[model samples]
Target: MAVAATKEPNRLILFTDAVVAIAVTLLVLPLVDVVPEVAREHRPATEVITGHQPEIWTFLLSFAVIIRLWLSHHKAFQHVRAYSTPLVLCNSAWLLAIVVLPFPTEMVGVFDNSRFTTGLYIGTVFVATGLQAAMYLIIRIDPEVASEDTPLPGEFVLGAVTAAVLLLLALVVALTVPGVGYWALLLLLLSGPVEWAWRRRHAVAAA
Candidate 1:
């Protein structure tokens, strides 16, 4: 029986970075459009920024979110030296979610906070985080994908899963609770402590 060939991951990593750059760039386009609308309305020049506070805020928020996600993706692939079909598919799906995020981000800025908008925005984030978690898990288990000299850390694998779970929890809070809205995303901060505890527990076990 013939074995499937593995390919170097450099091109895949470069492609992922390019897609992430485009997605991050797309997040700011709506804010740029606001400038023309303000001019047409004959409002004070400052209103271009001051009047569109919601849009500005959401753009900043999404920018931070996309950057953070990209950082996580970079971390996940840092130790990878090879790739397979499943890894490619997983990464593509993650990129698709990243591309879709700007739509919900715009919706959040334009529409009043509602279950639908909040759910949609948080849900897109959740999907992206979940896909990243899957990538970490795949890399951890697949000997063909990661480098033998520098193994992927167990904390990274658990941290990705922990972050995804927090995002899911945040999505649930945003959907079910009125007035909570995007504040629900604060749940994601728990990931650091959770991952720390996991590391401590494992260190004790190893000791």
Candidate 2:
């Protein structure tokens, strides 16, 4: 790797962090800033928030999803340690997906019961996770963009792939199941155990 390629790309990471932070912050505006006068006058703000329980749930779920994505990005970039045209392009694609999340998130809040919104939300997840997975592969292929002798941690790549699979499975269940629909997205909580088992097995193997 050239000396330039080995240098840390702090600006890239900083810019990406800002973008992700802004995207996550935008999630709250639809719930609070856009309250109608009717909602404002008839009830205490607390009560109004309570009444919008489903929206709160959607907000939290979307929030968690974005945070998961950030962590995956963080993991991959630790190995990245540099930059390239393909690497920058991959990062841009991933960030594009991140920024788009808030719209579908609002749609989830507005159309909690509608299959279209739910499917759209899941579709967003599919695209985002797919982009993230591509990022991992791109970094691996372009060693000049990575730390010397470094490969992405297996657990990290597995986690990203698991997320992609989980999203695809959620979409399938949402479409096929009679009543459960997008509630299948709650299945993402299962990634906790999956990651735990992945780490446990890798730890034992390393030992």
Instruction: Specify the highest-lDDT model's number.
Output: 1
Please state the error at residue 112 of candidate 1 in Å: 3.0
For 1-207, candidate 1 gives per-residue lDDT tens digits of 113226788899899999999999999999889888988988999998788889888889989988998987888788887887888889999999999999999999899587899999999989998998898888888888877888788877798799899999999888888899999999988988998898899899999
TM-score of 2: 0.83
TM-score of each: 0.94, 0.83
| lDDT tens readout by residue for model 2, 1-207 | 345565576888998999999999999988875467436577666765667878788889889989988987887888877877666777788888889999988987777767787788898888899888877876776678767767776666677777888889999888778788677877788877988987898799999
Worst 10 residues of 1 by lDDT: 1-10
Clashing pairs in 2: none
Off by over 4 Å in 2: 1-8, 34-40, 189-207
